[model samples]
Target: MKVIVVFGVFFFFSIAAVMAQPANRQVFWRDLQSRYEADSNRVVRVYLDKFGYFYPVNAIPIDKQLFLFPAREHNVNASTISSANLYAYFHANQTAQNALLNYYQVSQTGNFDRDYKKVEEQELRQISRQVHRLVENLQAKNIIFLVHGFNVTDPVSRYVFFEHSVSQKGYDTKIKPLYIEVYWDGLTSVSGTDLLAIWKHAQNNTRWVSLALRDLMRHLDDRLPFTIVTHSLGASVATGALFNTSSKWLADGNTHDVDSIASSIPAPVDVPIKLGMIVPAIPGGLTFVDFNHRSPDITTVANNIVGIAIGYNPKDYATSKAFFSTSFGATTLGCDHENELRNVSLALRGCGYSLAQVQQMIYPVQFTTPNIALGLQDHDFQKYMEDDVDFSLFLAKLFNE
Candidate 1:
């Protein structure tokens, strides 16, 4: 009897130990949760469901990283499971579940039209209040909004990057970090058609972003200055939000929209905002045959903004291949051009502009220390924070302090 009891006890212990082992999926979730919990300004909640996980809007902490997973529900199969899996399982509602099912049946089937619209409105209100509070607290400094790029479905990645960028550089004094994660829950497939559909969704998501920004600007104090940093596809969306859509205020020469613009501008000469386009996959005038077919309207905004910084890399396989296929009908290795921008110097070089030109147009600053080489192979921007490097200097340069 004693031996049997001991065996039962050992069996339970073994089972518990096995469950505790961290796998790729669980580790991802843990990292994501940690990032959210670290944020001082916001409270983040994460949920697990059949579709993987869902986070509250802008609830991700600014110093973590994770992969993107598409919401798939229809045509349920092995492909759907693998293609739509994001991080770990998160909670979902019947409506989201049904939408996921429909999305699985077709390439662009999910219509969060009604549900997401409501969510967007509610989130906008919440974000507006948050921005109001932030501006109230950090009255002395300028505000900079940072948006992340593609393949980042996890909110933690945004949080991790924001925290690291601000803390390493000690820009907390001069620039208050306002990180905004514009998520469309992009699909995870190498298929060109799927990728295009994802891009379209990203474009659609821009409306929510515009609403959020406009609302935030409305609440902010008139004295604060604002700047925006957009990476990868986020750059395209940001530019579209500002330039593609004609604002009623801009058309009527009303100063309502100008408030957001004027806050960022040192002197009003038609341009009222500063935009930093970092390691964007597609620039305004450039055309790639296979990747980005046309230059987005973002270029027009860049020209109009107070300052615009285009970061690129010649050796960046992603950018090179995008241009090669789109422009020359050749296919090259697939690499993420957004990640290539971390190599500050290479990013500047590939930006299709001279360093002096960038400085003259935006700000005369360079990211030094540990050198840009440290980030050369790092495709994940969040990794920059975890790894020991002198990234603080780069943060300092960003604030010009």
Candidate 2:
């Protein structure tokens, strides 16, 4: 009995010890850039962090080495990656950078979309123009965006791990896929007591940040084939964007404001416009048309979508109703419903969607938790994206050439 007890404890810690670490952002990106044929070749990356002006204009990245909280296990010289050294990397805005480095002092909850300095028009146009130029220079065919969940109080930590994992899976697709990291104020710090309040606040913020994403989609050339891949609560950004299709500001179809111009973007009949939600943190009830009109008509959206893939795990208790939501919208338990897709399908069937129609538009990708013992980490995006065989297959379906 003593021997068995000792082995059980040892086994648990052993599994934890092998927890993965993100690759050096500097090294990984430099190698990616070298693969391109053009001398000015570089990955096109941009950022948007507007605190609910319901505004989402492109912003510049931090230039120097940054020490951030929720720090990764191995950051060389104890300095984490600086968002952008331009043509050479990834991105984060001023708000997330400050809130993360000073987490202990931050307010319990709210938006982190303030700017330390007013951005000049020329500065804002620089990266937007660079991205457009790079697309033409590198002959880039597709654009990819990564969106994170609500629990990530720290942006840099999530950025590193997300980008590195995408690279590990060869999901970046050489120069063909332009990767953009989208960061929003997701419950910037822990309140210590009211997790429910913080969770609801985080859920609400998605609505606003999503407006920015919606405008960005309008700004993006309709000619560009783009896809947004989200994890956990981040699904709201992609879903919300699809719902909020046009902007009055840019509705005139005239390109104003910044240098990059789109003469009124059109429907994606000519290109692939996809949205992937991996263990998404949303109410499954919303997928069907709610008669009260509480949620968007996702059933209608799904049918027109080129591809919308949903990744679910019955074992992801963190996203289970018992934990993720304590009160309102608790029943649907979006990530992994109690009855899984059966509930979603049955509900869809009630709404007049044939299971065949639901299956065609909404591709449900399954993730088999490697060990039931891992528990809550089962919802960990890193584990799903890096450690699971099912995630690899899901990625292939989402990023098919």
Identify the leading candidate in terms of lDDT: 2
Residue 79 error, candidate 2, Å: 35
lDDT of each: 0.38, 0.48
State each model's C-alpha RMSD to the native. 16.3, 15.9
Candidate 1 per-residue C-alpha lDDT over 135-167 given as tens digits, one digit per residue, 9 for 90 to 100:
566553555666565545574555556656676
Residue-level lDDT tens digits of model 2 in 283-316: 5544433311212334443444456677887667
State the TM-score for model 2.
0.58
Clashes of 1: 28
- Among the numbered candidates, top TM-score falls to 2
